[model samples]
Target: MKGISSYADTGRFEEISLASSSYSSILYDSIRDRPDFKAGLSEQAHLAAKFESEAKYSVLNGFSYISKHVNPHKKWGMLINLSSFAKDANLSLHRNCIYCSKAVDLNINAMVDNNYNTFYVAEKTEAGELGEDIAAMQQYPVTADTSVSTLLLSNIKQGERAIIVVPLKKKNFSHCMNFIHHAGDGIVVDGQQNKLYNFNNNADKKIFDSLYGAASSAIKPARIYITGKAPDIRNEAWEMIEHPYFPDNDWEEL
Candidate 1:
């Protein structure tokens, strides 16, 4: 697994349960059950049980965390906006943050902004206290090459996975979509082959055809996170990021 895979998240995202006889994933089954491509091991499957379980449950994990601690009273407050995947603390999401809002019982006064709000991702490790200890994702500004699948996660190593949570619209809340990018190279075995795409190899042309706009990019934004290379002839505290493709969690101090 070395490239990023994107799945056009749709339909009822059931609470995944892999039966003993068959470790088939409800998410994977909804996409395709034909077993067209040969995925050697259970882990080889692009969005297998392991990957789907993580991506799907992380949402619940994050929501529970914010509801309990951030707003101990679960009252109106600001939350780390998850609208557009920006890593900078100051550059919070503009579009209504669904998950963050939901955590506070859909409190209209609960503004999704920066300030001291924390980015809720999965759950914090049991030993979490330090800033770097919390699992979070840093935003990698999408380039022309990154706009497509084949090139998005080309920089990551094989066998690892990345979760791609596509934010849904304000009107649509029933169907929640969660993408698991398992820098993987394989195919699934099931029915309904209409909603999957592997970054390494795939039969479908487009899996994310259902996704659309978030908002317009500003002419000159306040802050910008630089990924990949920091110019060879560098200046100040700038340095190269050893791993850029697998930036799963890079949040700020809570």
Candidate 2:
């Protein structure tokens, strides 16, 4: 008999046992079952084996395998080409990396002077729970407009460092939030707009406190920045920078 049309190889067909069904009902139920049940004749097992082999080799080459446990709907669980995953794996394998923790733990103070430092994190809200925007930044060096969904992704491409930002306090930041998040590590909040009096008055301390707090939270090394007058943090150990914005205000203080 001809195989189902949806099967990759329509000519292929698998044989099944009818021992569980009466001879009279065997043919009828076999025909009534779902297409996939009857379409199991293809070389799916062989294909899976081939994919596993490729996945292993890719891993040896610094590629990472993400188990499909996160989302089973995806066709493949292992994402081989993304540098972010590779970096995570590589960092974990480092002797001094401890437990191979996420880049979040790498000390920004030590890396502040390093030219290749590139990792950014941003706050992601979904269903009122914190999520990750790492995936979008992972596809950096984006080229060609794809869709509104990929707007963040299309703006970046591979071979570039990862950058993300999470605003601790403020609203009107969504417009430039993505840019800042992808620009570098750190927090950038509107002191004036958010009515962040303390932040405006103690920018440097706020910046230092932010990084110190993040590191204390078991987070990796991070860079913190603000867009207003900030007092200098005494004996500050992290990389902090001030980039003033919205200069129309007359209440300027260094």
Candidate 3:
């Protein structure tokens, strides 16, 4: 892969990401001397959420990918409120999400405003492969890892286009699960609550099949329920892993 720096086109702002809308706008800055070029993209993203059926899960998985990358102790699923982030970033499409005002909404406008390159992320289709633990432990013969966000937003955009160079914020949490337990209720993104419960305990794990939501309609989990026909296929060991931001965290005083 070529260096991401190859994509840089900003002047003052560090070119950390990309964006695109249907038409064009002056909301964001321009591409240096190229004043014709604009920044901030939103329309395509809203349209994506409008069409996708499982956008909530996709957004959660995207956050999961982010969590894994941004020095997290673990990468369990997360929940985010569109209004919270949208309002922070000044993207006014929070009311247009397909899930309505659900905690987990995918508004690219807000994401872009918040400095995420949704266009770039939407293009991330195949994520390579499953981890050894997941591959071996999973019932089916799983191989490569596909993208969930791609499922949420295809090549769609709103009426405007802009290229925003996002500053690399120290925090990559997006205030998903790691934060925002208050401010209101939170919807478990595609039922990652199961993993949250199982993995949160570190040493302690549930032997019996634990469940969430209404008992009448309660299912194993979005992923497991889709495959595991038998309700009793919940036997698996758990272990905590140390995913450090630095390589092996071997830094010593020189």
Q: TM-score: which candidate is best?
A: 1
Per residue, candidate 2 scores C-alpha lDDT tens digits across 1-254 of 11111111111112223243233322222111223221111122232343344333432111111111111211121222133325452211111011111111121211222222232111111101111111121211111221212232233332122222221211111111111122222222221121111222345334423322222222221111111111122342333222333221211111
lDDT of each: 0.22, 0.21, 0.20
Q: In candidate 1, what are the lDDT values of residues 184-220, reduced to their tens digit?
A: 3311110011122333333221332122112233111
Q: How close to the true structure is residue 147 of candidate 3, measured as C-alpha lDDT?
A: 21
Task: Say which prediction, candidate 2 or candidate 3, comes out ahead on lDDT.
Answer: 2
Model 3, range 49-141, lDDT digits (tens) per residue?
A: 422322233433333333222221112111122334344532111111111111122232333244332321111111111111121111111
Query: How much is the lDDT of residue 27 in candidate 3?
Result: 31
In angstroms, the error of model 1 at 192 is 15
Question: Candidate 2 — which residues are off by over 4 angstroms?
Answer: 1-134, 138-187, 190-217, 220-254
Q: Give the local distance difference test score of model 1.
A: 0.22
Off by over 4 Å in 1: 1-136, 143-152, 167-195, 200-205, 209-254
Candidates sorted on lDDT, descending:
1, 2, 3
On the 0 to 100 scale, the lDDT of residue 208 in model 1 is 29
